[model samples]
Target: MADTTGPISTLPGAHHSVPAGVMCDDHPDRPATHRVQGETDSFGCELIDMCDECHGEWKAYRDTPQGGVCDWCGKHADKLRPRRDYEEGMYGRVYDVCVPCITRANQEAEEELERSGWYD
Candidate 1:
């Protein structure tokens, strides 16, 4: 039988237990909301964004820079290729691939299309 559980979210790693404070930017007492960011304020101690992950100020910290260490998903790894491709689509700009995901995806697609009677 399939396990019926609560809804799964893309955003994992939720630590909402703020210590007794509004949170100083560089408080050693504060735990960083972004585990993978390795972020720090002007000071040496870790910085706490409104959303430590996204830096949404009102909700969390707002409009954070992309390419920050994404603690949310493991989409990125150490071997990320340097170049990327962009394309115009029905929904605006879309990523064709980032070289690596492209290579893997292309190979998979080719094999899928090559199945018996697929091209026939």
Candidate 2:
């Protein structure tokens, strides 16, 4: 007979399966399966691996005006819309922006294009 009731025997490996704990910064009682990394007023923009429940909570917070804040200017309101804008040279990389910031960026892009004679 072998002594199997040991820490080494219970270690996560080919013979043993260890369950990963909840990695969500907000919810610690659920299993984390989604990775959220971006700028947030409440969370201060960082990489957070969260569970589905926490992710939903985050989305709700991001979509609501009172819960969501502008990532660019740190402005908080209930009317600010969430915008996903792509960055230059960052393929498929989209980040959150406020309505005002997106509007400003669009205006700037239009002005730049006009100045470059790209529209003409």
Choose the strongest candidate by lDDT.
2
RMSD in Å for all candidates:
14.4, 13.5
Q: What is the C-alpha lDDT of each candidate?
A: 0.33, 0.51
lDDT tens string, model 1, 13-63? Answer: 232333343433444454344322122122222223332523343233223
Scored by Cα lDDT, where does model 2 land? 0.51
**Top model number, TM-score:** 2
Candidate 2 regions off by >4 Å? 1-22, 26-29, 38-45, 67-78, 81-101
Provide the lowest-lDDT 10-residue window in model 2: 6-15
Q: Residue 97 of candidate 2: its Cα lDDT? A: 56
* lDDT at position 32, candidate 1: 40
| Residue-level lDDT tens digits of model 2 in 46-89 | 34566678667878876655446767678764465434343432
Cα error, residue 101 of model 2, in Å, equals 5.4
